[model samples]
Target: MNKTIVLACFLAVTMIYSCKKKGKESHPEVKVVFKKKQVVYQVFTRLFGNTNNNNKPWGTIEENGVGKFNDFTNTALKEIKDLGVTHIWYTGVPHHDVITDYTEYGISNDDPDVVKGRAGSPYAVKDYYNVNPDLAENPANRLEEFKALIERSHKAGLKVIIDIVPNHVARNYQGLTNPDGVNDFGANDDKSVAYRVDNNFYYNPAESFKVPVFERDYKPLGGDNHPLSDRQFDENPAKWTGNGSRLSQPNFHDWYETVKVNYGISPDGKKDFDELPEGYENEGFRKHFEFWQDKTVPNSWDKFKDIALYWLDMGVDGFRFDMAEMVPVEFWSYMNSSIKTKNSDAFLLAEVYNPSLYRDYIKKGKMDYLYDKVELYDTIKHVMQGHGKTDNIPPIQEGLKDIEHHMLHFLENHDEQRIASPEFAGSPDKGKPAMVVSATISTSPTMIYFAQEVGEDGSENAGFGKPSRTSIFDYIGVPTLQKWVNDKQFDGGKSTEEEKALRDFYKRLLNFTINSSALASNYEDIHLYNRNNTEGYNDKVLSFVRWSTDEKLIIISNFDDTNTYNFNLEIPENVIKKWQMEDGNFNTNDELYNQYSSSLNIEDSKGIINMEIKPLESFILKIK
Candidate 1:
């Protein structure tokens, strides 16, 4: 071969090899064990590290105080990691609409009529390219502050996840830092058209958008005097509201602050883009991503894709999508497929409340996990509160048996009332048995809200947020969390005895789940069999068995909070055979605390043990 031709071939191979090396470096090898159950700790970023005790109703930032990016110091992240968490979901990081003025920093003033509270709702993202200024010590360095927190969290051995509200953007969406040549949402839209495949948002032709009329004495900033609190907003040819309100003048109860994004689906429910073929659900993300590479999708699809890639470039580990079901499942397939190609280990979780849509969102949309709210969480809550029986549980488990691993379980989140609240179980201890079930009954990941361990009852009557749920809208300090913070110590120094004990229980339970191999593998419900055969079994108790090649676990939890039950707990003969046990006596040790023990007698190929379970007690017994 000629020297010039040979040299050209060698250079081509070297270029290809260099590209491959860069790809590997771009997506670093994350710490992941396939099919291993993970624990997620969701902490409201601006609320997690706040040490302030002043929580006034409808208070300003100075009066109520706010948490910031610096609040999540190395010390704070370390405490969260020690709780057996693999991922820390930092909620409310993006720049959202706020009442605070940052005119000096070149940020446009957000009218109070379009903002949720003094601090603003995290879901109403104002700029996709910036971090919330309220979360920074210096408004100009907000993005850098958040990036530092991300690095700190990673160094502390916790992956970071943030929200991606795909259904909508803030009504006053701005792109102060959008990269050159990228147009903001609706910047090039034809306002005369109601729906267009290429348009970024759904428009209402010839109409003007108005702020929601006040209902029953409601006012912006609680009637405080602000130049923008005139009960008026300006939008010609008003866009559709986030929650699908068609009215230009949305009701006070509507999501008026956000405008829905158009995903190429027409107003008459016709698709304007190509649909995936029949068997695409079973295909891997690479194939799904490749298929869309040559297809022309809606403008909103590309817009959201750019935002996701930008965050991924900034070293974000994953996203917890809000209101995921509102958007088409096909969009998730396209968006999440792109995400997975960039970081194959990206943890993609979504809030899909509809049971029928769960599997589609998982298989078709490439979602890693979906909230198990409609079934497992709801059933467990019912039984814990003494409103339902354990008998209701086995059926739900049986129905979801095929996809159990894809269902993420949790007892408390930002949207739910606290377990210690009067509206809930009214005691932290009441959640112990339920927590065991939620965390250990399946192979899915388990999530705990920030302060759920020590029990923040969400009973504060902070303005814009009443009792029973933490206000994602207002700037306020979490009282129970502050005790644990103890002035940024993150040591729980001022926590009460009851709070300390509850936190210990959580630490023990969560640590065990991530370390145990059996939890992520096999499972069988022994509750039904024991209910019919056991001499003293009742409807208030639940029993299950989890096993793998490395270990075995028999979990039992008594939901009855008033009485200690002395019952002869029995495992079915079939379960004993499945465990390959011989007819003999085996010592039983509690894996949770290692202080409790009992004897399991296997007779005639059936396992039976004497049990004295106290009220709200749960035991993870390992037969040795």
Candidate 2:
């Protein structure tokens, strides 16, 4: 479906309130236009506002203070919005298993052996109907505090997105706060059989669950003394691990902390649930919901659907599904279609890396967006590492031509290595050119992890998770981001000069992307044209053109970190004729540097643009 059509439908359904005219010469009714390009800011909830400097490897929650739901004040949210953020993905919001005890609040204790770290893995969801108690001011009112945060985010003109780990749940699955009439996962399962169409989890009939043997210097509870940390968990029939490992004792590298949810797929990889009828993709969510009303499907599907609707009703704009491909695409089709029936504009993004399944998930699964990791992100990383060529980028964009707009672009997220870490680029400066190309190469949503602006190298040894990627499993504080937080000031007062400069560059680039009409319009790759026409243009340089009815932009980037390139970029005769450019000299201004300007000579229906691009720099030239 076209985005314009979707937006129009959403507006028609949602725009019902009209302003009352109270006086003569009433103020002109302002019209709001949604931008085609979106910017997502992903922040790990546990560490976003923590100011503690203690980052011990396996530190307790007391040793490293956790950021509360109230930490995202209006001032902080406004600051984030000013950075050109349209949506704030509040990661790790759902109630998950943790080492801390919340038994006083009617929550059962989670054994440390089944949890990942002191804080536990956010992907290992414990309860679908409650918010993480560690994030609330009062453990009794955790859900209310989260609802208030959602309201605050909307008031600040930003949408809220939270994670939905539908593929799996914490090993010790317990839904303490489920709504009335809703049964927990596996509540009606028969453990005697290993496969059942209506069962919630896949069982190992005769095997008992065993904790994975710890290697290296790690222990089940990080060597901490606790009665429940005896390396034993009670499960009569061991369920499959989150990663599909059938072993009763999963290896340390496996996703041992989580258990896979069964979605009516039998042990031999056959789907047993009722499939959506042909031509269902073109139908609306209401139609899909009505179709499933009387149909008998797996119990797990209904449970997940209820969980999703609950969050949507609580004012969350959308969800970011974790490991989405692991679940059956049919389930997503049913769930997401139902969600769209409630709110057509809900931003549904999934983490799907398989290129083969990308189209299936987006079209058949009813997902709005999928991560562009295997192609765009990996290509950029290779180019930044100096082993790949810019020539590889144009083909990727061409390959995903039909669904390019549905691909979400990002350099860093919760699961990926930071751009400035030693395992990646080793410096944030290397990401400047790559980021520019990533943002302007297509009309997709771009995302940035928290503290990526100030170059947060996730180098801490935060228990279960090592360096490179920030710790999502431990009680820890991000080093560089902590300075910017500056004890809740959110002003970056303690940032170094280099750090501030890096952040300013990101701010300028992201803000420009959101406000530019050409970027949100049409894209045409000029890399092949330049590589063919220009003599000195190398693989280290990339160029493209973005245009709309009223504006046109020529974007060029130098991916090389230590060399400058001076070349005459060429515009094909076909493009010049399409734009109806007259045979005359045109002046161009750089939107990125503002101080740089160059002349473009158009003769005989062809244009020659001269550029001297610095190392790791990009130029967004506006035709005058």
Candidate 3:
């Protein structure tokens, strides 16, 4: 049979089985398959277990304590797993430039002028082979400590993911602990040229690098009286800034702490590297790796691939690529393909904001998932802030229908503001409805930042770290999350009643997401139907349906924060026909809140649902 006819026959069989009796002994057994929905919990490694109550602005490491790799004990990992998290993204695990002194451990001290804060920017990686000394109980055994943490996470049924900042490195990049025969970046570069395919970085040979001039209330080392805080950096033949700024003296706003890596892409948008074959997308990563074995590619690509494989060998489950779009897609195609060759199940997530480049990065770059920041995330934020309507969601889903599974959904991460912050919705309650929609609207994985469940209001004034985002650049404790930590108990002993309730809600939602078979099945939008048929159903409400052969769910959310809504939601005829439902009265139970029970009347191949939804409430109604 032709491919189209084969697909039609397969779908027809699926529909017939979908309408089978629930527990009919006479019916033949049919296996139901579902892609497990993943819930990722991101924690800044330095701050996750820090019990420091003294959060002085720009405080020294001594004043403000830091969490060590050993802090993620079995108890801690178990708590996280119980919260229904499948993956733990350990941010800032790699050795980066920090203001703290680690010279006693044979590590070089970083200049205060270039570092962002006392802890420094995690993206400005200084050593790829070594773990951060600040996170180790014993500085010399840092790598071992991290490996142990990875084992612990895996023991608790959680996978480990660390950052792979391929686009840039610390200005003073040095791999002192590199394995034998491994060379540091720029060591073999011919620095005279402005750009070279083999050179690891772009150099400006004519001028020396100057430190950016600090403005406003900011200063080098937060105005602390340090000898090296003289606004002078020693770099002969300055390199390009991480943000692609070519000026020898980059502005303070530019990514001045790090230098961009050269990936065979020229300054004028020219590609100097080999492109993937036209039919390469259909091939496996092992094939791609074999294709590059004999080819002479850029030296930087080889180095990154080796780094990724090293982590994979050490039990690291995956990597979250930083600013992946900034680097060339062809290089990612080469690098990520090599990573998958080593471990095919390795989760490769990229941060790519440009919508136009989404498919190119996923298909050509071999990325498993990319942040849905510019579209779904931005739209959800706008609706939460009372600026946009719920009608914007269905179109976005339809537009990315082919690639929705590849687009990872998240309400907050390291780069975004907290939901409880003044700049966002100003309260954690506003996130309930948004999180419901973000988690259930697609088959994509959902990520929640550390302390997001208990409402960590990122309102601290830590040096070099502004409010609205937990300071990744400073040694600071998250207030709300600290309560749950309760000084390393990993229990909510000190959390307020409301905070505990919020965390419980998150637990329920995330656990349901992972266990729900319908989440990974077919989706049908019911927003337009309810808007047209149900009176008093405003833009604040959104509804959809997800169904598989064995499971069906009607998800509805009320985005409004003030008034409760009572309306009759109409289920479209197409959805009823797709599910092969017969005309009758069906009983439905809310899976989210089991106390609520309702009846759906199916007539004329359509259904009407009577719902009395509270403000910011959501329902996952299971049809019976």
Candidate 4:
């Protein structure tokens, strides 16, 4: 009897242990610090104050410097910060030139920003080490203004992210050289080349063409057959010219926006070399070898890692990598790891404009976040155009699930068209509600482009034209901009009465998102909500639910010009607390219970709980 009893006890203990092990394996909670998972507002410095629509020539960096990012502090940006944005991304902080030459034809209205000194494209960075003196704090103060801006941002409790162009550099800045004429740039021909501080390089998948002779101060390089070396390294290596692609062509120097890289000739393809040729390998092979060539940009990996660390050390939470697709996945993976180590809560958002490009970034864990351009584009453009409907909502919600941890959602970014006006073919007041609905309710982190809050509007051409428009924000201002920022009102337009109501509505939604675990939920389930059978429930009504084991948030946005929709929600009973509309209106007690789980009419124009939408509008309802 004693032996049997002992054996039974041992088996029971083992069973319990097995169950516990399985439980642990079945589900693991995420360990992430969401400092501010609410909403983030973006500011494009050039367009903050003045209404410069045409990128017309500004006097000089000296004259325009005051209007640049330096102006962002007091008005638009400050307003946005006050609106409760947890993060701010300032575009074009580093110097960028709009490389068009209007001199021969005379400056036209379409020219963006004129070449004050030597206007080159912003993407074609002249150098990373130096700050655009004009854009800095004092004319000669250097990185001071940039640093001060960062300090101010921190004091406001907002995390700031600046653009980093790791893939390319400027074509016209002249070679980095000493006053005595020593080509002391990163492209020196001697053993001390690695130590040189003048030149920069990018990762070359198929190395081609040798490093060209450095040309100083825009002086002509006598060498022929070299590509501009400013544009993207060719995807097709067979296109390489023996000497260099662009330089080899006559008059190629006239076009200074892009350039090809340097690489040695191979029977198969062009091979990149940092030091002198292989047979003449008298120099230190390891140090001199250019890592960016097929293998990796020699020290680029370390350099970027250090850059990430430097920014974080200075109290930045993360970086929004530009042109991420061009760089090697290994570079981002290393960067992501290093930044997370320094600040585990760091938000690494990659600007991989296309959703198809998100695979590698997601798989390698190289990026913790990416822009969800697909859903946003469809919601703002197609849906607003009256093409797709509510059924179209499923795919977007599903896509967010797959990339939830690394997703940043938005209706309009600096790259795309504004959400209001011609883009939506609706009034600024009408289009705004839909934008807010889409942004706040989406599973991904929301990003509000600079002029978004105030019902800003413009055309696609406004983004990249001539020297006329100083900044992107100069188009139009709607009250939504200030209201969302100051929390004084949620009004989508210029009306004061509407602003106060809208403000409360917005606050309720924002607070709900921040407090609940739904915003952080990554569940990809699609069948969880059903609105197909209801009348007027179509693509016009965008709806999705984000839920974890403990919490859930149901987001519904109407993109119709003026349509009433009834949609049914399948949710657990006793979850909803109160219904909060965009105008600070609410329904509770008996009214809520009577409408529970039923299709509620949304009458946006009538100021009633009817599901009637008045053009572009968004809604947020709180669950008890």
Candidate 5:
């Protein structure tokens, strides 16, 4: 070969290598750095209350008038922002069915307190584009209020995420229902009426009909069912007959009660009926059905794209999808694709309760946030509540890895029980410490549920057709059980020194969790360092770690019942640096301690490192 040609080839090779090296230098390791932002605060439709001793089913942001939101905006949100929260999720904004007949769900309309305030669970939406009247500034100026709220949130530097329920429509929503039995737009209410074969309703294999098996007991303490205290729900549903009784349904299903959507096709190459005849053949019905077949409802795909774009245009940051499993993967694909077309920063967090189903969406990049139920339940709730042992740590660490790659982490959400409830019932002395610790120290995107700030120990499962006073707050807005939350010292309330210390610990923990560098970057490499505990106090200590090529954070949560702990841990030989203490102390070791001790000492019985977590608390020792 000629020297000239060889020299030219060498130059080309050198340029390619240089570009590759530059790329590696700019972006080293697959680390997803979490921006130093506050854990997202999620507000539910059913939880908001007023000073006038009213806990109506639903109300508008504007109607609650400045007073209600003032607490949320000025106090709650301010605290959240101060603690470094990055986003907020406001669920149930759309219109829902106002069920006048409470007997349908075992609720009695008799209680004068059962005021159906203009709106219901926003999930039962009559219109997606319009905000519920109760949440509006005035009936006519609702959208403006939403815009203003978004503006306020943005000003506070919080990304706002609205909930989108696509799986089903409200059972009794107006405009969609044709009173004359003939659907004006061919949108039927029949369960079997499906537009496509894939849209068929889920049927239990054991049962002959298309229904799910639900437990009768609403609250069972230990099992899947929660006990039902409501008197109206005593009758068995299996014994009851429907309009056209083909057979008695022994098992429970997500039927019209929680209407299941038709994704278009069935196993038998048929469409599940909404309310009309299966495969209805009519020019009007076919045309309307075709329109409904498209994912963007109330309008065409182009229009739906515009709706999503409109929110983005308003500086809205993100969205949290409800029952995302029911939505066609194509809809999410289109949403993610279309969203990227406009802005890259827009985040999408889907509420897919099942992890396996969630992964499908995550792989498609359909969402950036998801409910980390596995870790939240297994590690935080179970461990801190004295329900889990040290053995549970390994699974939790593994679960965190799966969740970290594709989710914004959160603790209890609207669908589940409240964190402060007896289920996670740590004593005001014990639980609060663990609660604050777990909320802050995790690597995935963290979230705070409504009423969590004030430490409201409400039930996680409220809407199980029960009339119980165990909600986030009582009817008369005295903030029943408010002591569980109020950071007494900060709020100028009279709390003991220990209580005050616990409250301050939470603030500090929040600061450290969000600002940590190692946690922000390669969290997967972080392993569960030490989950060892007192032999008899296996139920107490919940310890773990998050480390990468550069740093490590050891999290220890003790949920013991006044049991002092003294344990040993095996640390990685390379891990030497330690910084910050939960008790307002910071530590540094310029001279590295080059040793791999099989057992590290654990003197403090309960307290999160860096945040000074107290009994029933969690902490992180930042090692970098």
Candidate 6:
């Protein structure tokens, strides 16, 4: 060190201190207080508002009855809002390949060989500019109907989010209502080459597209007679499949109904567009937006950008991207940055399974949140199945502490098996404890599927979608949810006593989560401490503490399905010191439910609480 340099540094520090003190005096340093936690209610839009209870396997729209946009009445939305949800993710709202014929409305009939079921797969989006015709009472007014639903959702104190499958598009993509200057996906594609920088899709010149050979007993439309059900599709130059299969005839397991989008990355794995600049990973979304404003990109990138902006302009609050890892991170950077520029509060979430890419997706790609599937969800699932221990959870929380707030937690969504399904926990009651830990363990956003609260089993074998997972590909009614719908009255009149009880539990838990500032603030895992020190605290029990400057919470859950736990659960001396707790009996009340009587005793700098937890029960004790 140089003497002059040291002196200059000291002066700089002194000046900064002086300025900070003056700024504080004028600005009046307010107490730091976080907003309420976010709870997202994800609904399969087609199945949510449907009142018809008749669910037949492989049934037509007339046989099973499809839900319409008009079905989401104001009363229904108000009921959902009362569940303490801030956002509603409306799944399957876009147009896709469906077996139903709409030629009279100037909509081309989708070939059954190229479609998944009579209803269709939402991932294989057919049009970027319109809503699904099946969801509308009149096919011509589908977009208008969706806009009205958005208005209703907003009026009910809920934000609206929809899916944007940027990785691929329907095999027969169409833009029936493209804006004045917008063009369809492959309108100007040069099919002469297999890979091009500006081409909308990758091509296999001289090879025509072929439908996959079906397995025995599995047939499109159940081998019914239709002009477009011949297992024959017309494509002069076959494009790569959605999952990146280059074969002209993809395997049955591949995403055969969609075509892969091109984002300037060629077959040689060389980038045709400019890679992100140095240190761009640490830049904010606004800077990312500015970086791409003047840079020209591929056609698919431009088209998807237009589509996303289109929806945002129509009052959509945000988007949940499908299979986001399959697409390039650079494209997400451009897309998400552009979205934020339009609406800075847009909730952008993505499905990136690979844990290695989680940080990249959130930080560099400018995504608001990513799925915590591989670590949190999977570990919790194993625990519920009796094969995993509560010990395996805290390590995951510690590992992701740096990005924990950006990880969104959920129990069920469209892709996963329902909690009440035979393949899952075999009963919805087993999920109670897991839901508590998942929602309050960290500051992450909590999401619950539409019928999850009422214990939907997803056991119906509805055509293309099998048991254990609800069908996203066919017309079918969710029996459990229908009982709660009760003929569009939005009341649980037909629901069984057990079903209503489960929903009531969800209501109490979710309401507490959103209104509690501690849930969105500081956290510490006390599971290990209790296991080592507290007697009778087994691996089936999980414990933690969540606190803020204003509130303190001690949460404990029992995962055992048939065991009742009674023990003196210890809250270590160090944790008590953090809470500024004194050595005496503190007034405490269970925030989750008031059924249990809890007493806290602290003596000689040690804190302990006598706790009695029932099977699949959780207690959120608030210290007074």
Model 3 Cα lDDT, one tens digit per residue, 495-563: 999899999999999999998888987888989877877898989999999988888899999999998
Write down the TM-score of every candidate: 0.94, 0.94, 0.94, 0.64, 0.64, 0.94
Local error of candidate 2 at residue 511 (angstroms): 1.2
Question: Which candidate number would show the highest lDDT if scored against the true structure?
Answer: 3
State in Å the error of residue 251, model 1: 1.4
lDDT of 5 by residue, 375-415 (tens): 55556556556666555545655655644535555555666
lDDT of 6 by residue, 1-624 (tens): 333223212211111111112223222222333457789999988888776767888788888888888888999999999987999999998888888888899998998998998799999999889988989999998999999999999999999999999999999999899999998998899998999899989999999999998877888976678888788999879999999999999999999999999999999898887668987775656668889989988888888888899999999999999999998899999998898878877889899999999988987898878999999999999999888999999999999987887899998999999999989999999899999999999887899998999999999989899999899999999999999999888899999999999999999999999999889788888899888988899999999999988899999999999999989998888888988878899878988778765778999878889888889989999988
- Candidate achieving higher lDDT, 1 or 4: 1
Would you list the C-alpha lDDT of every candidate in the order shown?
0.87, 0.87, 0.88, 0.45, 0.45, 0.88
Segments of candidate 5 deviating more than 4 angstroms: 1-34, 45-49, 54-76, 99-119, 174-258, 267-307, 399-403, 426-442, 459-503, 523-539, 547-552, 574-614, 622-624
Clashes of 4: 78
Q: Candidate 4: lDDT of 166?
A: 60
Runs in model 6 deviating more than 4 A are: 1-34
TM-score of 6: 0.94
lDDT of 4 by residue, 240-303 (tens): 2211333322132332333322222232443333322332211111212222234433444555
Off by over 4 Å in 2: 1-35, 282-287
